[model samples]
Target: MSHSEQTIEREIVSKGLTAPRLTPTSIDEAIKDEHYWVAPGRRLTVCALTLRNGFIVTGESAATSSENFDEDLGRKIARDNAREKIWQLEGYLLRQRLHDA
Candidate 1:
């Protein structure tokens, strides 16, 4: 997490609104499986994550120049993008759960 994000999370935790309820560790654990691959015949990396509840989310990373394409870097970027989406989705789910409570 970025310094700013850590600060914000500390503030929220201090207020007891939403902190321990939806944590980064929990988010990481919520994923049941993960997969990554480069697009055939292209310099694009695709990441797929399957949530514990069987929901799937995908993210992609592309190289501007084929000459500079690095498979390892592309996979990292793509997987990070996919995990970021999971954060957003899980945040929404937590909000809904709070509302319904």
Candidate 2:
């Protein structure tokens, strides 16, 4: 479901309930920029997310075996890890807004 605050408010109005939730679109919206970096040996990858407010969050992935390291997979894993952090942060913001409302 769309997770914009407006959308959630509408849902609550119609449903007569309150439950703050986060959605993919909300996460995507809060992210102002995204970047990735690989370590010198290419066995580790880090993903950085720049939020709309200019704060940065990062997550990383490391390969236990050099032979199994893949740049594409590492980027995906690292990005996912970073996105998870975004979820937590966004969730907190959502809950705070709901509480204040």
Candidate 3:
């Protein structure tokens, strides 16, 4: 993967998130959703949250931009990505709950 992608992968891992396997198909699948696109095609990102009370709260995005990067812009994008991830996880949990119910 590229430098930026590698950096993102490291950040995600450092944050204690899930790390998806590093493969073209895996990366493609993960990146299909904005929330899962934490790294480039070769870096794996993982979920870092624990389920509770039938609700799923996302831990955090593993990817972080450079220190010199624009903080405001990065924060905006991170917020959007985090929102998408939380919604995705919530949908999964809801489906599971419905099945269990």
Against the unseen true structure, what C-alpha lDDT does each candidate score? 0.85, 0.83, 0.44
Q: What's the lDDT for residue 92 in model 1?
A: 91
lDDT of model 2, residue 95: 85
Write the candidate numbers in order of decreasing TM-score: 1, 2, 3
lDDT of candidate 3 over 1-80, digit per residue (tens): 44565687788778888633343223333332333323443223433332333333333333343434443444444544
lDDT of 1 at 45: 96
- After aligning candidate 1 to the native by TM-score, how far in Å is the CA of 83 from where it should be? 0.7
Alpha-carbon runs more than 4 Å astray in model 3: 1-68
- Native-to-model Cα distance after best TM-score fit, residue 41 in candidate 3, in Å: 23
What residue pairs clash in candidate 1, if any at all?
A: none
Candidate 3 clashes: the total is 7
Error of 2 at 61 (Å): 0.8
Best by lDDT: 1
Per-residue error for 88 in candidate 3, Å, reads: 1.7
